[model samples]
Target: MVLLKNYISLRDQAEIVRICHILGVGPGGLQRPGYSTGHKLQLHRTCFGRNWNQETKCQERYNRDGSIPPLVPPELVSLIVTSVQDARSHVNSHDELPLMSPDTALVNFYTATGRLGLHQDRDESPYSIRRGLPVVSFSIGDTSEFLFGHSRDEDKLKNVLLESGDILIFGGRSRLIFHGVRTIFPNSAPPSLLQKLKLKPGRLNLTFRQF
Candidate 1:
């Protein structure tokens, strides 16, 4: 069984570095592409499901309906599964997390001028497992402000800077906790990666999901 501990990466950096190198952020040497949301709110998630986490783990997030963009190709789904498996090997079973398998990848791209509010990956239809599922998130390009909270949206919150190659996993008991990205660290990313990309900010995130 995996143990629940705080910032497991701080104590196990070698393992973290190995995994980050193995699981580089952004698509596997692919260019970023643009897609249309049809200019509409497809609202695949609901507030009820969002509330469940609030009452339980106080989390509010779920699987997105969008698929990986075509222009900006990313690693194959199977490859991510493999990478997730490889990364899990570094987890501290007795002090960090238990076994988990991330199947779906919700790739998020942000620009230096963009901002994402605080939210949690809780109500995702596929991860609605009452006990909650682990969300394996990888951050690449530019450091950003990552916020975390305990229960209510307004509580003892913590802010952490998530730079390129940072992997954050939240699930199990922590799955429903409220969390979000506040701001981008402007120009904290590589010029080559940002200037060459079609997307803004040059930051891309791939979150592995079981759904």
Candidate 2:
């Protein structure tokens, strides 16, 4: 895992929040197949590329009803891809980084009590999964206690504090690690960040993947 602290500036963070607000936020219910009702997170999701199917672990251009929306904005994809390459280059000079392009994004809004269950990001295509393409995640707003483990055993988990403007990249051997948020620190977001974004007390995480 490559953790970049304070990687995004306040100005950029504000812009991202603004865009998300314009796009929309919600209580993204169990819209994907195989997910039981009420098993979904109380967060919003703005998808890009073909929508991801949690059940099939694949991307489809249309939903079961045959509807399609625009893919993630090109500018946003480029911004993240550039940052990932830069970080990868600095961390492993001998290894060549894959040409990463984000085809999907999950923008999650977590209130003070919201937390994600331990899960692996294994929804990408077979080729990308085989290559172990990294998932680039951006954190904004309140801090979170992120937990990760090779297995589901809680005793084996390692914890990390993910603060606002932090970026996390995990792939290769560590790509399939089980990870989730343990807690979100209440009222921990920077005043400027909340005010500029006009968001209530909560944390916002944008995770970009190759799908």
Candidate 3:
């Protein structure tokens, strides 16, 4: 796993947030995802290019409202490409990191009290998992306490602060590492970003994958 601090520029951050806001007001917009057992997650989510149905535990082209999901914007795709390159460059692990062409993106918003339990993103195709297709994550809005470890043992996990504009990527040997968000620090967003985007007191995260 690699974490790039302040990887996204302020202008790009605003643009991405703007795009999310536009898509989120529509029929297939941001809504809380729940499991088949009727347990709702702590975040609001929407998808681009493909919708991940939490109940079915699979990807769907149409959302719960019977609307096609918004396509993954070209600009965001370019950003993911560059982010992967930069991440590989940072760790000098180009050979270990496979090239990624993200066709689906999960855009999630977390309130101040929101928290996700430790879990692995293992729902993608087995071939994708075997090839180590990376999950490129972008963070904006408030800072969050990110917990990640190889095992589910909480006491042995390591914690890091994921601030706005941070990009975290994990692939290859680290692709299926257990991870979760512990908490959000209220009023921790950059003043400039808050003023420009007028986002709520929470965290905005977008994770891209090939699906």
Q: Who wins the lDDT comparison?
A: 3
The sequence of per-residue lDDT tens digits that candidate 3 reaches over residues 1-211 is 7899999999999999999999999878989888768899999999887778765665566547777887789999999999898888866667678879998888999999889899888888898899999999999999999999999998899999999999999998889999999999999999999998888889999999887
Prediction 3 global C-alpha lDDT: 0.89
> Which portions of model 2 show Cα errors greater than 4 Å?
25-34, 56-66, 93-97
Query: What is the clash count for each candidate, in the order shown?
Result: 11, 2, 0
Candidate 2 residues 32-132, lDDT tens each?
Answer: 23364546665545455556555544455434445553567776787688778767865664143455788887767788988888999887788777877
Give the runs in model 3 whose Cα sits over 4 Å from its true position.
none
Tens digits of lDDT, candidate 1, 1-211? 1212222232232333234333334223222322254332111112111211122432333223222322212333444344445546666552244344444444455667545556666545653455465666666667778788775455688777776656676655676677777787777865544444422444565556554
- TM values, all candidates: 0.55, 0.86, 0.95
The TM-score that candidate 2 achieves is 0.86
What is the descending TM-score order?
Answer: 3, 2, 1
Considering lDDT, where higher is better, how would the candidates rank from best to worst?
A: 3, 2, 1
Clashing pairs in 3: none
Worst 10 residues of 3 by lDDT: 54-63
